[model samples]
Target: MTDAALSPLRGLAKLRKAKTRRFSSFDRTGGNDDRLHIEPGETVVIAEHAGAGIITHIWSTLACESESFLRKIVLRAWWDGEAEPSIETPIGDFFGMGHAQTRNYASLPMQASPEDGKAFNCYFPMPFASHMKFTITNEAEHDLLFYYYVDLELHETLDEDMGRFHAQYRQDRPHAPSEEGRTNEQVLFGSENVDGKENYTILNATGHGHYVGVLFSVYSRRRSAVWDWYGEGDDMIFIDGEAGISVPDTIRKPDPRIGPKAKLIADRAESVPGANDAWPPTLHGTGTEDYFNTAWCPTQTYSGPYHGIIAAGGPNWTEPVTLYRWHIEDPVIFHKSIRVTIEHGHANGRSDDISSVAFWYQSEPHQSFDRLPGVAERVPTFRAPYRNWSAVVNKTRS
Candidate 1:
């Protein structure tokens, strides 16, 4: 790691043999224009490079009339001539803001700067050996005006062990609602879950790599319930585990030998069917709030180098809540495949809109992502339980 407090002379000496290049959206015709105009449904190639290089920095600012434009514009990046993009996500969510809203926040690999968080920056080192291609697609109705800069450090030779950067976005609007007539209390304390099949999936990747981090956002919809907290779910990550593991119908019984250190344990053996004795969670977190580096229900917004709760929602948790966690100091390494998932609520009970972006580096060619939902489906919607004040007043009077 390059120490930031080194002497100026030492810094200069270290850079004497380094070669780097930058690709920007500045006017190519030597004019004053420094932005690109992207029409509706248009795709623009922002950066294309051949040979070995590491994209060290990315900065972008966009202008659009639609409030949902941030979620409409899609960004995709391909490395090493792969047909499938290694990075594919909405521009805003890719930078940390979700639900088409922006706010100033900072993280080690990504950040949204001041002035209402219009400036999006990323410092993830995306190294490509043969070629790298990045493009932005405008999926909104209105045209988009954008300015971007992709700074790259071109190395004469790249290290053989360098991994390619990858990111994938996924969203489940109102994760399949809990079974009808199932109350929150029952879901929380009565219901048991051994296999994580019903959990909201953050990432299901097959590769040999380390997960750097993830950005998760949720828009609450349940209102009838007195309690509006949305993060009671536990985080379960299976690393390099066997495939086609049969899920039990009932929760599994906890292993007596594992001791209490095991964060996630099978509640009952009869619940999980065909689960082998060796099946155990690789990394388990206490709760969703705990996984994001927060305790209890977070009500205030905060940002840091590795984790942050960018948006904490409004009164009654009605608004969207966004959180990010970067495993820079302690990355989750996986040799074969990894499945990262978290419950929507305790035991997959709550029905709320959830979306996430997973960032990691791995050897390509990676599994291609499924087609993204169309613009109509991608748009966010809010639903609250109906309230009748008159009825309450009448009942109280009677």
Candidate 2:
């Protein structure tokens, strides 16, 4: 083999050897532990923790350097307590890539230097709470420094308890001919049905991704289904506005292709196969069988305040399903009962034979509607009301 091929093998071996002995000390208190030290000139710091793993809130500064000149400054973490570390590269499915690695960097000063350069902060959730390591490397030669902090405490999030998530289609009647796609389904639930006393939080999503489906809408009996919570179809933690962007129209699924269209577009943009020299290049939908083309559609509200599970893909061979987790963030303020209506078919009046579905939410608050004030019957609303939505519009959205 040539030197280039052999070079990679040698590099891999070195990385493997350096994998062990990553972290200096494991401190329980959230205080400075000088044992975790690095040479001022050194670019990277390797940290290791057993069982607890390593979760870090990292900040990077480009001292005396322009971001363009700063080649590669990244956060690398290894899963197995042994194999060579892996940098949390941008989102891609090349080998070991999953959730998009997010960054929060400070604004760049017109004149960049050590006294005042640019900085970026990012949060990392390791693969597991097992043996882990963290390293930050600066490929740039300029004197750059990174501000690092570690969080030993696992940030607790409100537990999601979706009570009585039941789905009963227009009763699969006994001794009746089964319908192909028109079994006319009703995936319903109530927040009060949940078991635990702990309240829930609401998570609304929108936007595009693999296996994304149409009719990604939410509804409650209280307000009109005029507004839908949008998402980018990925787990992006947000504090305000819509969690994800809504696609105005759902693209029809074309014939499946062999490779990902998004990848193909990316290659072209680079000028090798086809490259578009855009900072954020255009992403072509993989209208192929492997990916879905549903993009930019409005999201349905979880009705009052309900928790919902936005999931996709499973062992079963059917259209993907998303289960709604209710009363998650706050009390699902209900004038009446709450039910989430979903349809696998096209929202523009097209139809399909949905395969499987599931739902769960707590209903503890409404042990008896008679006791709660103003608790009444509410219905589903839709801009273009169809099926269950149409039936509930007049009685609800007014």
**Tens-digit lDDT string for candidate 1 (1-398):** 46467664676656534467888889989998899999998998999988888898999999998768988999999988888899999999999789988999988789999888989999998998889999999998888999999998876767788888989999995454455675445544335456777888788777678889999999886753344578888888877653333455465564334222223554433223323112446676678989999987889999999999989986656778999999888988877677788988876777889999999888876767867777787788766533654564455457
Q: Could you tell me how far off, in angstroms, the CA of residue 397 lies in candidate 2 after the best superposition?
A: 45
Residue lDDT tens for model 2, 257-327: 31122211112122222111221112211111111223333232111112222323211111122322222
Task: Please give the lDDT score at residue 322 for candidate 1.
Answer: 95
lDDT of 2: 0.26
